[model samples]
Target: MVGAEQTLEVEGHPCVVVDRAAMQYRVVTSDSAAVALERKGTSFARRLGRRRNTVTVRALHELSLVVERGESLGIIGRNGSGKSTLMRLISGQERPTTGAVFASSTPIMLGVNAALMPDLSGHQNVVLGCLAMGMSWEQVNAKFSSIVELCGLEDSIYLPMKSYSSGMASRLRFAIAASIDPEILLVDEALNTGDAQFGDRSMKRMDQLREQAGCVFLVSHSLDTVIKMCSRVIWLDKGHLIMDGDPTETVQTYRDFTGHLAKGNNISAVRIRDEARASLQMTEVLTRGKSRRSRP
Candidate 1:
């Protein structure tokens, strides 16, 4: 049996299927892995022993999950909890150190810091970014006006991206990515960067994207945002999934864990952690239901 596994459902149907075996891998610490090689022949064995004690970090261990179409999935965790790393893996920007990630379509990532060129105007960057994402020149031209309007950049769109504030850059990037209406969208803290008006519009767009059978993964530090936007939420702590269920219950449990830690209640924190682990339902097999046919 796999070390960890889970089933994903969207509405009453399962549109996306994921069944994976346990994945294990290690990452060498930066300090130790970057040390200059100074071991001579006589000290080789001694050096090897020292290397084994490297201060390594595990971004994720034995992770297995499924995400289906028409569901907006929220991932919440504190810093160093592997949220961005998981997004990178799903977007195909980085391969997992072990195991594999499969998707029905290419995932588009809307990051807090977009990869737009600082030297290029926002207008030029929009065209360039769309093209880089595989939109044809003609498509970019057709959508240029709508993209600019969605970003609300107006004449400022002519200015270089370097001149824009961080929020502006994030808005432009989100507008460009959302314009694509990708099948799998991965968002990382981009929503909080926009104003309330823009946030409302963006939320509407995301809703429309889901209505069209697309899947979205949002990684946010804002629990309120996750609860408001996602139908299902997963709590990940220290690179391990602590809970996965209805947004309200999972988020509350996560909040309780953090609250205990904040109050210096080690006993309560330990108790909560133990209970969460015991409730982990990691192994699941998807079968056919009234709404859809099962996969082989």
Candidate 2:
């Protein structure tokens, strides 16, 4: 089961807390032939029997962290490293399989796969996206031109979103989400789709958000961008948080680990990873006037 608790913490509050959160999914390890047979109307009892071989895939291990207001935190990791899972949990889009996420406000997530209508034109999507973010009609209208300009879609704004390229759609999604100036923002790989000019604009927008005392969480593969934009960085590997600290040190360590892997130096990679895990400082979670430390 997953759970989210909205804390009374506000934009100017001290911190956003993720308290010993973890997530896992039960996967049935049935063969393709069995799946085909089930799709072809196999007996319910037989399907149930096949499903008995279920495996629990842990997406995140008891992860605990704190983010202060007005700070930009970057998350870096390899694919399937639980970065997206943590973002989804923070945004309340999904619940942790165990533990809880407490936030000052509902985080607005800007992802490459944000929910926008493919059949609708970019113009319509901007309106719908803004409204969905709790913006009034007047607010949407006021920000409409700015959003289109930031996306730099120009005439293409009239085209159906399904006809746009992935980059174009990503830019529009980012523009719409940024227009809201959310108190808590979660960005996942949306900046990777834009060119240098758009990247500059996106960076400036995030800086402005931070200046306004909002908290920002960025999940990106671009270590340079993470170091340049984030005040702090956290590294996750295989569903566990391995390092958290200054952007430069954490990213450099991650780079070294990956470099070892790229050169097929599994032994060196494992050594570096284990050393980081061993040195990690666990976070403390407070509940009902009692405090307990949580392991990552």
Candidate 3:
């Protein structure tokens, strides 16, 4: 007789997979984890006085999840919920301190001021990034036009990315990456940097990718985008996987959590505000960073 299977720990929490047939490994977070910003007080000796520095640790105990083919997934959580860290670990950019991460494909992160290159032009970087991703020159050529058109950078495709606006750079990066057709794509709030018009176009391209190729793991604070674009959403808080189910439900829960912070609840409002601003911009415009939006 086949009994019920059990949830296993990947990082530090227990994880259970719903669809075992389509995945080799799932990115899961254990419910029993700390999402708090625990600080260790350190003293630095100064000529004038001793200054105390508070260092915050964003730790995930155990998280396990399965990302299967053709799945458009959303990761949502509060300001120190360890959402971004999980993405980094899953994408092979960052290693978890304790547990393991299993990825079926390479994952890439697109963040503001990430400084992937401060010296290269957008065109030069496109070629370089594609090559780095293991795309042959011939393969890049085949996908070149489609990538340019999708990013709407026909006029500025040749511009030095440093001279281009942040939005322009973001569009170009997304275009090149999406066109590469990786088996797995990790997006960290890059689309929100785009203009409203571009956001619509980007969403369409993402839909095409899901229909034509593989899975996409999107970590954004925008509930609206998650609900509209993703088939499923997962919520994390203080490095804990608090909710994993429908996009609508997960997003709503996330919103409520933010609202609580805004109202000065038991949560850390300052950190939440910063996290929401820097990380959730894909969900909403960041009033602090660059004051960006296309003019009407």
Which candidate leads the pack in TM-score? 2
**Per-residue alpha-carbon lDDT of model 2 for 95-166, expressed as tens digits?**
999888898877878765669999999999999988887899999999999999889999999999999998
- TM-scores, all candidates, are 0.80, 0.82, 0.67
Best by lDDT: 2
Supply the TM-score for candidate 3.
0.67
Off by over 4 Å in 2: 1-13, 30-52, 281-296
Compute the lDDT for candidate 1. 0.73
After TM-score superposition, the amount by which residue 164's alpha carbon in candidate 2 deviates from its true location, in angstroms, is 2.9
Q: Write the per-residue lDDT of candidate 3 for residues 165-187, one digit (tens) a residue.
A: 77777777777666655566777
Report the CA-based lDDT of candidate 3 relative to the real structure: 0.61
Global lDDT scores for all candidate models: 0.73, 0.81, 0.61
Indicate the residue-level lDDT of 5 in model 2. 29
Query: Which 10-residue window in model 3 sums to the lowest lDDT?
Result: 14-23
User: How many angstroms is residue 116 displaced in model 2 relative to the true structure, after the best TM-score fit?
Assistant: 2.8
